[model samples]
Target: AIALSSIAWQSGMLIGPAMAGPLYAIRPDLPYIVSACLYALAGLAMLTVGPVPRTIMDRGKGPIAQIIDGMAYVGQNKLVLGVITLDLFAVFLAGSTALLPVFARDILKVGEQGLSLLASSPAAGAALVAFVFSFRPIRTNVGNKMLVSVLLFGLVTVIFGFSRILVVSMACLFVAGAADMFSVYVRQSLIQLNTPDDKRGRVSAVSLLTVSASNELGDAFSGMLAWLIGPVAAVVAGGGGAILITALWSRLFPQIGAARSFDPAEEEA
Candidate 1:
């Protein structure tokens, strides 16, 4: 199931840009129009699906109480907390993708077509890694490997920040994407496998919150930093911060480093 999910996700990543770049080249507004139509189709398809199952809901408790309980549960679970914290900080600091327009127009001197390539490079790398992992998922030293992947992600972001050549920048982003894919897969698997069945929905809510904060908040952070500092300096500093956070998280969440596998029985024993 996990492998299939990963493949589906990567397939979208692979196809979206492959289609978007040419569509964007033909017309700047075309991509948005197509995206809106696709979204409408998706919504219609979703309407055809069955209603939400009662098993996924917590009917016994008020919404506010349920939210509080979920937060408390996450706070108490060291593994989940560690994974979430690592993701939050790493993504927050390594969000150079938010500044791609600056890089494309100013740094690389590539026009819209180049911007499309730069945007797609990371997804291409991620898709490749996801495709490989779908067949041979990581089964040992999951936590340590995830941490290492984050470190690599940060390092590549730093390289991408300093790069003047378009190809070099693309290569750096590609490497960063691969590293990020490893971290994401491991973190998600750990969260899903470790959380209790009764609290799964709430835990998923928490995960969604973290993902939103990391992506949206991180974009805001990148923009603000780019305004305060130069874009190159901002990206370099963010990458450096990510690397430092990885070191700090390694100490603060030793349990994550010690975790051997995503399998519940293996984790328990």
Candidate 2:
């Protein structure tokens, strides 16, 4: 995970500025195409790298049975369901990033350079903090940390929504990114620790799908909402939604509240 994150972070840092310089000159939407290409290449690399073992793969079940069993296991596990739902909700509502170019240009009047920063600021902050976490892993109440991080992320989104100044908005986004990094670590670690060895592949695939669905769905929602109610209002609404989601999820998932460490023993496997 660290290796993949590093590769993506470095690749984006290198390509983002250069792409923004030229593409935003022609069309602000051009960066999305470039991003799509980069992601496509990354996906290709992963495919070529071959299959990875899932939690359930060690059980010796047939391939189709393995998939079905994973689904059944996930359905039976409230903790897993809660985490997955939380991930989907948070990512779906908070991911307004794809529309940042429009926000920078039309809303904040910051132009393309600002757009580039807005687009990449969260990842930049995440990459920085992730680097720190890689060297010295956090040992604390993981669940509370995730909740706090996600809450802060929502608050930062609200701050960005209200700010007219380019620097202020960017700073808010940077803070959001930092918070999101903590959330990512907590969630991913939780998934790994809780899942049975044989079911890892299917669960991971489902998680990946959830991520793609949330991001794309969030982008569509943001774009439509912005068109309907205006950009600032849309962002503010999304922030409000994120806060509500955190509150509801906190009440619903007591296991998440019990998270003490990143140890597999902390959760049932």
Candidate 3:
């Protein structure tokens, strides 16, 4: 279900830019108006979802206590810790998306239309991969596949960082997006399968928090690195950092590598 939802999200991403480009050319405000309408429709659609049964917290466990418990649980679970931290540092370092404008304007010299294309390429790639996954889900060696996806993400980012040609940069971005989607699919699966139902919400909260932090902090990291060095250099170095983090995390958390699948019926890793 999560994977399918992601595919839907990616489909929206795939279509958004195509609509925006024409609307942007017609009137910049037109794109904004369309975005607002879409968001409203999304909110309305969300209301259709029925509530599911949830685990209730004990009265004795205060908010702070629950939070502390979540922290402890996350800290102790090797597979959980591995996937979460791997997501954090890999994304935190590969902040290359922060420089799309720089690449489009200064480097590629493709102007607004080119920028639109560049922005859409990754979504196109992600949407394609997700579409494939819908029909053929990955059912083996899920952990190592996650690591490999992140590694590929880093490698593509590095290529994008160095690419001067518009086509090459777009190609790299496309692959990067595909790689990121693959990793995300695996991460979400393992995290959920590994967590108990009572602990799922708590673990999910922590995972969500980590992902949110990575995106915000990642942008800041990219911007700062660009200021220190050139944008290309910053992106390139960040990609390298992501690659290094992947290798380091694999050794540190052997449990992740040993994880074979996400089958709920399975008794062991």
Q: List the global CA lDDT of all models.
A: 0.88, 0.77, 0.88
lDDT of 2 at 157: 90
| Residue 1's lDDT in candidate 2 | 69
lDDT of 1 by residue, 115-179 (tens): 77888888878878888887888899999999999999999999999999999999998898888
For residue 173, model 3's alpha carbon misses the true position, in angstroms, by 0.8
Least well predicted 10-residue stretch by lDDT in candidate 1: 1-10
For 229-260, candidate 3 gives per-residue lDDT tens digits of 99999999999999999999999999888888
Cα distance off (Å), candidate 1, residue 41: 1.5
Clashing pairs in 2: 54-201, 55-197, 55-198, 55-199, 55-200, 56-197, 56-198, 56-199, 57-198
lDDT of 3 at 101: 85
Q: Write the per-residue lDDT of candidate 2 for residues 66-168, one digit (tens) a residue.
A: 6787788877777677777787898788766766877888888877677777777777777677877777777778888888888888888988888888888
Candidates' TM-scores?
A: 0.94, 0.84, 0.94
